[model samples]
Target chain A: MMCYIYDGSFEGLLTAIYETYYRKEHPNKILSITDYEKSFLYKDVFIDTDPNKSDKVYNSIKTKISNQTLKHVFHAFVSENEDSGTWIYNYLRLGWKVGKKLDLHLTDDRVLAIHNITRKVSREIHYMQGLLRFRKIKNDVFYAPFEPQFNIVGLLASHFANRMSDQNWIIHDVKRDIGVLYNQEEWVITNINLKGDITFAEDEEFYQKLWKEYFKNIAIKNRINPKLQKSNMPMKYWKYLIEKN
Target chain B: MEILDKLKILADAAKYDVSCSSSGSSRKNKKGGLGNSHISGICHSWSDDGRCISLLKILFTNYCIYDCAYCVNRSSNDIPRAMFSPEEMVNLTVNFYRRNYIEGLFLSSAIYKSPSYTMELLLKTVKTLREKNFNGYIHLKAIPGADLNIMREAGKHVDRMSVNIELPSNNGLKLLAPQKSKEHIIKPMGLISSKIVENVSERKLYKNSDKFVPAGQSTQLIVGATPDKDLNILTLSESLYERFNLKRVYYSAYVPVSKHPNLPQISTPPLLREHRLYQADWLLRFYGFKSQELLDSKNPNFDIHFDPKCNWAIRNLHLFPVEINRADYEMLLRIPGIGIKSAKKIISARRVGPINYDNLKKIGAVLKRAKYFITCQGKYYGETKFNEDNIKNSLLANSSDKLNITQGEQLSLFSLYPNLLPLPDILTKITGEL
Candidate 1:
């Protein structure tokens, strides 16, 4: 059985799919570089990153299937789940067979699994848009540090660009070590490290105190349900939140 | 005074007024504007009580002129007082919005000096936010008896405005809040409703005329405070929605903060009762159930054990055993535990072919409760016959109690065990009756 190995990038994964169709040979499984296995009987076919092949697959999906379907597949790719490769493969396979209306078949497990991952990623992005608290730094640029469970650092750029159009801001995902920096005109992605001696705005402490006070006082003491708070705002995001901190 | 102290006092005073919706409008951010309103709204945080903290809910002041027996901020009560200037309010809103800490501002105020005076301050704050090009959502409370012109002008700059009818009945208002009258409250609501209608027709012709409360209006009714039954409250809400074209009717379970003679003899707010009222209200708004349909004169209040939809479905059991694949959207909605989302899913899925029990589960329908009311193609999967007590006991047996309702008179609000009742879960999901 042949095992197709890609470079752990979305484009590389697409190129592998292109090769599977081009060679008319089905692999036993598709895997990324990090999850490589060494064995006796497994034939390893390394997939080189080809932009032309990836673009062909991308355009074919937008034309042959649906653009909305492509978005769901891309969102599931960034979900970084262990079952993502197989489920997305099955989803695309079913999507191509059912034409544009594949999304309506909720009974299909592959389609259901892909939608679930897409929901998780989108939910995380939406929650981050609310939970991310920005603090002004020395250069008058706003910086927020968070550690989301999913790799959605690049997904939040367009939302903040539309909302905070007048200010320069940075949203840093500490776990992945990458961040998006926006300067009102455009946004750039870079690997940023800020655990060392990050400076704050002069009145940053004062605002933080006020926000904590508001969060505490807004709760009805007669109706204190700590379990509910924990369910909505889980403890994983607590250390980065201003009030939870 | 320090800003932290002011926030503590104002936010503490404002906690009892439970209207935390940040939805209904989709105002885009102008090129120079600082923020925009999302169509379905966004929730920033959840308080310890499981209530959503969407907007920056705070009163402009805690000082008041009227003495209401049930209120903590009445003239007789000696609570610490603080107020924010219009400019300070604008600054706080803009900064918090930029930091993504809130959806917008929910600015309510006490009647300092007079109702008009308090409304003028709220109007100034919202107008300044608009003039400064901060396009975030703002839900301003229109003080009853405020000048009509000032209220209309305030509506121009804000997304939503609510004139709370705190007490449902006239006698309750007279006994508890002698300074307030039912007539004074409804006057502003009527005017705002007419103005909203006028603005819609005018904008249709004029194209770019400034919007007047583009998200429309809503009001709140404090439940469990007086002896009014759920039927009276639901009937009033039904009329409000029909007469005023109201966007929503919020039900805040009365949290007993003051010791008063006229109030009910309860130490804790009736959480289950309040939850039941919200469930019935959802049926009225979304499920197309009328006030008379959910309850009758024989039973003025909703059933404490079962939800309103479940109760109604059980009573009309002849309509049950509906074929999931063949049922129309409205017929599917009548089945217990099937919400608008799952109903739409069933409709779309059936178009491809026949559906079965596994497909129903995949569509996110609450199969435990829906099983008793529906059949898949030709076969029924329900355990109990068409009987009320049997279905109710089975539903209770199946649920894991999402809410922490407990037993006895102490009525602890912090219990983790779920007799489990908070219908619709969140306030903004009021459109989804399930």
Candidate 2:
């Protein structure tokens, strides 16, 4: 029984799949090098970082499966879930043998498990699209800061680009330290550092005052249930909500 | 007056309206307007109380002249009163919209000074938002007993209008809220509907006339408050829809705020009952179930355990075992657990070939409940008995256990047989259903 180890990147995982295909050696276990200390007691085979092998595997999977399927697998990898790496390895192996019809047999436990993680990530992306509260900055760029449970910064780009087509917007995911910038015409995802005091628009104080006023007015004193409200909008997410602060 | 202080007082008063939905309108920003509206309106955030906060729902004032018993803001209640000027409301709306804090405004108010004066103030707020600030997508509440001319002027600027038929029956209104009458509420709705129709007709001829209340109107009916049953409530709602051409009818479960001898002392609001009524209401609008078909004089109340559609289908077993391929759209809607989406899917899929059990699942049918109602071609996949009595007993037994879990009660034999054992005896034994 041989355990295959690769670099923690998604491309490195694809390269390991290339080796599994070429060598025809079924791996007993598949893991990332980050989990090396927790490696199982089995014969180990480390695949050296090879760009050509990674490209070949990426191209093969792209051609065999639809772009939508490849995107799901990529999202599952970036989610960094507990069993994500092994599930991707197993899903691809079965997918390659069965061809494009693998998604139809979702009753299989391994396939269903991967599908569940991808769905969670997708749902978070949809929720953030609706829940993202943007604060207007001086440069006329609308800025919003969020801390989503999953790394969904990439998924939110199209939503803002389509909805706020005529305006500039930036959604910064504070948890992952990444941001998606939409400059009216296009959008790009990049790393951002919010370490120091970040300055907002000059009109920030005025808007904040108005928003706080509106928030205070909307609550019905007759039915003030702090417990019920806390259940819907948890206290953990209140730091970013302007009204809550 | 300070706008901040007034907002706090007025918004706190307006929070109990429970109709904060900003959906059902597709208004866009005109040349000078600051914002656009989507047909499927946005819910900017969910409030802590699990309600949608799509709009900044608030009143212009909480000071009232009429003494309505059920209202917290009645003249007799010793609460602080406040009002916002039109300019203050417009500024707040524009600022909130720019910050992505709210989609639009849901402006309601208690009748301050007089009905005409309060309606004029509400109208001034919306008119300033549209004409002065170029704000888009305002949902204004029509003050009952307000002048017809004021309501007509309001229809021109706002996207939607609602005059809540608060109580179901005239007697209920007289008993709970003496100041309000049936005609006062229903008249404004009738006037608005006719004005909407007239405006639409004029637009068809002129090609550029401004839209009048493009989102139409809706009303709210408080559930479980008065002696009216589900049948009576639904019958009234049906007339409100057919006669007034209402876009929606919202049901708010009664939450007792004040200690009144007449009102029931419920520990928690009847949220589950509200949910079931919404399901039944959806059936009325999209599923083609009339009020008579859903409830009757014998069983006037909805089943507490199962949803209304499921309960209705189980009681009429003769209608069941419908062949998927041959069932018409209307008949397909009658089957339990087959929603509008699944019924449409069945129609479209069966056009190519005969549908089977596997095909039904693919079309998103809830087979756990639909199993008793439908058949794949000729083969019935449900339980063999198909008798109403047997099916009802089995369904109740299965559902009572699930209800116990949801109500945070332990599963006991006595709870499993609610009809046979007295509720007090069961409560003493298990201490559940508190």
Candidate 3:
């Protein structure tokens, strides 16, 4: 049995994948770099964090697989699947041997598992786009806070930035303590500290009033099924929705 | 009054209008326009029932002079009613747009004071949003009996407009809703259609002419309320699309709220029936299935166990085992598991090389479902029996055990006794060929 340790980052994982392919050693087990101490009497190899090796692997992936495939691999990594480390090792080994036709073996169980995880993460990212309802604060900046099931805050930035290009808005991933700030033309992801009280301008309140009215007015009393409504727009998300209040 | 109170009342009233789609238009941002509508569309929110809330669907007023029995906002109902000023609605839309909370407005209204008066308020709201706020992508509801001038003015300002053909038949309307007449609804729809055609032709000659309801028109029909079968409903919807140049035809399942002697006392909403109708509707629009082909006098409803397409394939077993290589695009679309995308893929891939079963999976065909109906080259892998009854029984047996167990239970009696079943059940018996 052989244990390989990689630096705890996406690039580090890519470098590890590169080493596994180059070494050509069919290791019985693969472990994260942080789990080095946990390796029990196995042949352990500690990989030095190499940016050049990571870049080479990324380039090879970009050339061999489509850009979409590289993105799927990255998303699979973010999914934090329990068996992903081993699966990534095998996937890369298979891709290196296949040479630019990796998707041909997508029906293989191991490849399909990775693809499924990646698809789930992608779906979560889309769901959050529709679910993330923002409120306007005093400075014409829109503010929204959410605690999504997955680390999808980074994925949602481009969607909002493109859709709400003319307006200034901030979508805060409250749990992760990071947000996407869009001002007129450009948008950037930044760390935010929102522990203190937040306030909106009088005009913001005026608009909120109108939105609240709109939300209330849209529900048909004849079809007022709170049970059904709770299923779609959960009570957990109501705190941030303007109408829920 | 404060805008919040008005929002509550209007949102509640407008919530019943089950046509919240903001798609089928590709309007771009003009030099000074605040927003634009994408053809693929954007859904701003998904409501509790897992339905997408695209536009800010709200009514201008819940105070109605016409007392439709099925409506909560009927004049007879003792509920608190409210109306939004044109200025208030425009402000709400602008503010909401700035906050990234909505795609656009889905402005609808009750018959407040008079049909003309209600139409005027709706027109003013869209006008304010377009002219004063410079907002774009508005979908206004044309009042059924409103003045043609008001409807025309509405068409000029908004992206899309709809006049609900609430009940399928005039008799259904007479029994359930007394005040609304078939002519009142159909006449305005006809006027809007002609005006849209005129605008398109005029724009061809004069390139700078203003667009009129560029998203086109859509209408909704309430299902399960009247005695109309799925055949009747689908036939009418087919005519509406063919004649009106409609962008979409939405179907809302009737949820009985009133304890009227006329209505049925049902426990759950007819969601499955509504879903089947929508599936049938899609078949009519995208797939080459006609309404008459889907249902006839002998069998006038969709199969509850399987989707309309799957049911159709099972019934017509003689048509099955179509060779994927030789099958035309339309024929490929008729296969149970092959959607438009998959059919196109098969067509494209076959041009390059002969495709087998493995290659079909690569193109995203649901092999489990398609396996029964399709052939690769000359080899047919479906059941050896190859009879309609055997194929249907096997398909139903396999499908009933899967996700649609409850639906199977609801439809079991109909599948057994087609003629003796109720109208709803009879409709569920005939499979639509989408």
| Cα interface RMSD of each candidate | 2.1, 5.9, 5.1
Looking at model 1, residue A8 earns an lDDT score of 86
At residue B209, candidate 3 shows an lDDT of 89
lDDT: worst 10-residue window of model 2 chain B: B425-434
The pairs that clash in candidate 2 are: A217-B11, A229-B48, A229-B49
lDDT of 1 by residue, B1-434 (tens): 87778889999999987787888888888885688887878788777676777899999999999898888999999878999999888887777777788889999999999999899999999989999998888999999888988998998999999999999899889988899888889999998899989999999999889998988899998877777778899999999999999988888877777888777655556677677888787788887889998988898888766788888888888788899988888888888889988998888777766899988898899998899999897898887766777877888888655544445534442242222223323322221111
Evaluated on CA atoms against the true complex, candidate 1 attains a DockQ of 0.60
Which candidate wins on DockQ?
A: 1
lDDT of each: 0.83, 0.75, 0.74
What is candidate 3's CA lDDT for residue B198? 98
lDDT by residue for model 3 (A1-245), tens: 78777766777887777787788777655556644476477887777768999999999888876676687677877666555667777776666676665654544555666667887787667556656776767776778788776667778887666556666788887877888887867778889888777787667777767665655545444344555455545566566676666
Could you tell me the C-alpha RMSD of candidate 1 in Å?
Answer: 3.6
Sort by lDDT, top down from the best: 1, 2, 3
Which is better, 1 or 2, measured by DockQ?
Answer: 1
How is the predicted docking of candidate 2 categorized under the CAPRI scheme? incorrect
Tens-place lDDT per residue, model 1, A1-245, is: 88888888999889998898899978877788877878778899999989999999898888888988899988988888766776777787787788888888877788899988899999888888778889978887899999988889889888888888888999998888899999889999999976677898897787778788898888888777777677777778778888887
Model 3 in CAPRI terms: which quality?
Answer: acceptable
Please write out the lDDT profile of model 2 over residues B149-238, one tens digit for every residue.
998998889988999999888988887788899999989999999998999899989978878999889899887666677889888888
TM-score of each: 0.94, 0.75, 0.79
**Every candidate's TM-score, chain A alone:** 0.95, 0.83, 0.81
Ranking by TM-score: 1, 3, 2
Candidate 2 Cα errors over 4 Å, as ranges: A1-126, A136-141, A148-168, A175-195, A200-239, A243-245, B30-33, B132-136, B259-268, B324-326, B345-364, B377-384, B400-434
